[model samples]
Target: MVSTTFEDLNNSKKKLITDALLNEFSHHTLSTAQVSRIVKESGIARGAFYKYFDNLTDAYNYLYHFALQDIHQTITTDYHKKFQPDDYVDQVREFTEKSTNSRYFELVKMHLLFNEAHFSTPVSNHLIIENEFYWATQVLIHDAIKQLMLDPSSKELILQKLANVLHRLAKEDD
Candidate 1:
């Protein structure tokens, strides 16, 4: 995601730095993520990372925003028009189907599979905070309701269950 943004960054060095940041952030949470690994993986000096971004958290935040922007453009703008909360189910099903075979879907699945426990921990501790996830999920459910693909009440129930499951996944101590 961030890679495309930095693809024509007009600065080759900066592009490499951004790619490395994105890779590391995707693989690890902010707490357990390491800057040295990114530096090594990016083939840049350790100091180069600091030069491009303020710190690991800053880089993560930036990449986070970048990924969300892409997700929004891909799902909302590409296939749908207005956001009708009632049509959420159809939207979710449609988008899910499309994304099911896409690299994006696979990436999301990988994140969910690997980071379940990490995310659940923060959620349990009231520390899991990211608008991207919330917005993405909301969009999914909202569309489902708007499309009448799923019962409104059922959609709400599933969303609630998702929140709890996410929390447990993140907080489960290994």
Candidate 2:
């Protein structure tokens, strides 16, 4: 199989459309995401939107890559090197609070809430980064949990149920 290069991946018009689509889809449901609004926000002509993408769903799929890129960065760049279970909880809490200012936080939140078809096309740069981030987090947490099992002092109850805790915190505040 022939390999694709960065030049093949560069599409400025498509990226612009995808960026606009991410903002729109995050603010509204899939059914309600308006192409006109996306075009208007992107400052691109309506025809240009279709020229770059097949339709709204195509646009959304493209936008998913962008959101995944942002999330992958957040998970990897902000992750702690040393596992302090309580510190992990506090960091996630701080992230939850800081998410209000994150441009793509709504998209990330929506992704966690609803199940949908994942973006299928390979986004060469971000896809690999995301895979690495996901696997690294899983491995780190697994090791941490294992270590916690060995030492009572290393274990923190609050960290064990962080997912449930964050969900509850968001639900209560929203």
RMSD of each: 11.5, 11.8
For residues 1-174, could you state the per-residue lDDT of candidate 2 as single tens digits? Answer: 111321253588556655677788888776678999999987888876666667777666657665656544554434335433445555444444344346766775665344243433333334356544444444444344344333436345535665444444435444
Candidate 1 lDDT over residue span 59-116, tens digit each: 7666654544555454553222433333444445445455444334433443444533
Which clashing pairs does model 2 show? Answer: none
Off by over 4 Å in 1: 1-14, 77-83, 90-174
Q: How far is candidate 1 from the true structure (C-alpha RMSD, Å)?
A: 11.5
Scanning candidate 1 in windows of ten residues, the lowest lDDT window is 77-86
Tell how far residue 71 is off in model 2, in angstroms.
Answer: 2.2
| Runs with alpha carbons beyond 4 Å of true place in candidate 2 | 1-18, 74-101, 115-158, 162-174
Weakest ten-residue segment in model 2 by summed lDDT: 1-10
Q: What is the lDDT of candidate 1?
A: 0.52
